[model samples]
Target: PTSVSSRVYVTIAAALVAQLHAAVATLKPFVWQWDSNDGAPAWLENAVRPAPAGAHNTPIGLLRRDPRTLSILWEDGHRDDFDVRDLRLACHCALCVEEMSGRKLRDPQTVRADVSPRQIVSVGNYAIGFDWNDGHNSGIHSFNDLRAMGERAAAQSVENV
Candidate 1:
């Protein structure tokens, strides 16, 4: 009797899962498009609009708001504003971060509040390298990581509000 009841429960769960899958299959696919500046494709725009790979990581502009702030404008129209000190402290260079153990070698508390970049340079098309005012410049930050950080910061700000 117990075995029969367990089999019935399993059958009901499987039927419900099949129904859920069928419902999901009827839903449309989409991409969080920034804009169709590239012009719409021949296919139904939403149906064929594959998410632009690395679109957010492609920087179109970089601005220095002051000695303490940096702003990056991405190809997807997303802007990332980073405090210079914070960005400097987050460097992942071998000197700052132990390459073998993945331990943090640089203490954030030791980084001065006024720490900033003396220069920012494009490392090919995929990343940016910085010449920090404190003479630390080995770290190259990938645009993908930058975009992710910006997204997280934006979400956090919204949550805090």
Candidate 2:
């Protein structure tokens, strides 16, 4: 009786483990958000990174006063300004970034200096999608990635100043 029960327990444990993995896979997209700290827990470190804690990184307000810039106010009181043209050029859509090699296919010269967003839409809760006047709308830039981009741009600006 013990031998049979142990075998059943092993099968049940395997099924439970598989279910847990599936559940984690569903939440992987949320967990893999870009983080300022640039690391993750040991269990998920290699597979899924992390992002800002909850509402701290959520966009509270989005402002586009002109075609030149898009400003976002985060829930944590951080404001990030993004250049319209640069955002267009930095699109990670399949058309902008190669699907297989991950190389950037967009040539800076191909993007006009005044290229701007034709429409802006939210992608669920985690991303902002842009439709460019230049006729590309496939890229959906996540808020996490955008935050990182803004941070990099600010760093460069500071270096120049």
**Which candidate comes out best when scored by lDDT?**
2
After superposition, candidate 2 runs with Cα above 4 Å error: 1-55
**Model 2 error, position 151 (Å):** 0.7
Under the 3 Å rule for N, CA and C atoms, how many clashes does model 2 have? 0
For residues 47-154, what per-residue lDDT tens digits would candidate 1 score against the true structure? 222226634465555556555666776655566898877777778889999999989998788888777666666666667777776888899788788888788889
Q: Residue 52's C-alpha lDDT in candidate 1? A: 64
- Candidate 2 lDDT over 87-146, as tens digits, reads 888888888899999999988998988787666766677787776778888998887888
TM-score: model 1 vs. ground truth: 0.64
Which ten-residue region of model 1 has the weakest summed lDDT?
A: 24-33
The models' CA-based lDDT, in order, is 0.64, 0.66
Q: What does the lDDT read for residue 74 in candidate 2?
A: 59
